[model samples]
Target: MFIIELTYKVPATEIDAAMAGHVAFLEKYYHSGHFLASGRKEPRDGGLIFARATSKGEIEKIISQDPFSINGLASYRIIEFKATKKIKAFDDFAGDEI
Candidate 1:
């Protein structure tokens, strides 16, 4: 699994302008099984994406295509982790490793 953190580089206005396209990008990945969950941050400065990928390189390739990144609206920080534990109700989120 990977946690993708996006920190806005441009103004909120610019971010909003790109919101539709950004969401479309996310939707495509969701259908392809690349992204699991995503949402805006507490302060609304940026956003976060929870995803499952075969490797860091694969994740990098997908993220590079996000509208936010392509438009220079935000910067991405990708973190990969193992799910050693999780609630049974959400076990599926941890993928087959659990």
Candidate 2:
């Protein structure tokens, strides 16, 4: 799994301006089964996304499509992790096979 964190690089106005496109980008990935979950941070300074990809390069390619990235409105911190365990309710995410 990957945790893609997005921190604002430009002003809030710029981020706001791209919110709709960003959301659409996210929805596209979600429908494709690449994203598991995503939302804004608690402090609203940025956002976090849980995603499944074959490799970091795949994740990078995916990130490149984000509106925030295309408009240079945000910076990304991509974290790759092994999904070794999860709640029974989330058994699909409990292995490294993803």
Candidate 3:
């Protein structure tokens, strides 16, 4: 599992301008089963993405394609972790090792 944290470098107006393209990018990944969930941060500073990948390289490659990254609107921090425990509904994502 990977948690992608995006910290916006530009103002809200700039972020809003690219919102449509950003959403399109997210939808594409969601359809491909790469992204599980995503949303804006509490203070609206940026956003977060819950993604599933076999390796950090895979996630990085995908992140490079995000509109925010392309437009230099945000900086990203990728955190990878193993899910040792999760709800039964998430069993498929947690993997048998959990």
Which candidate comes out best when scored by TM-score? 3
Candidate 1 versus truth, CA RMSD in Å, comes to 2.1
* Candidate 3, position 20, lDDT: 98
Question: Which digits, one per residue and each the tens of the lDDT, describe model 1 over residues 1-98?
Answer: 99999999999999999999998999998988778799999898988999888888988999889888898889999999987777775556556631
Please write out the lDDT profile of model 2 over residues 3-76, one tens digit for every residue. 99999887788888889999999999888878889999978789999988889999999999998999888899
Best by lDDT: 3
Clash totals for all models, in order?
Answer: 0, 0, 0
lDDT string for model 3 (1-98, tens) is 88999999999999999999999999998988787899999999999999887788888999999999999999999999877768876766545331
**TM-scores for every predicted model:** 0.90, 0.89, 0.92
Which is the winner by TM-score between candidate 1 and candidate 2?
1
lDDT of each: 0.87, 0.86, 0.89
**Model 3 weakest 10-residue run by lDDT:** 89-98
lDDT of 1 at 64: 88
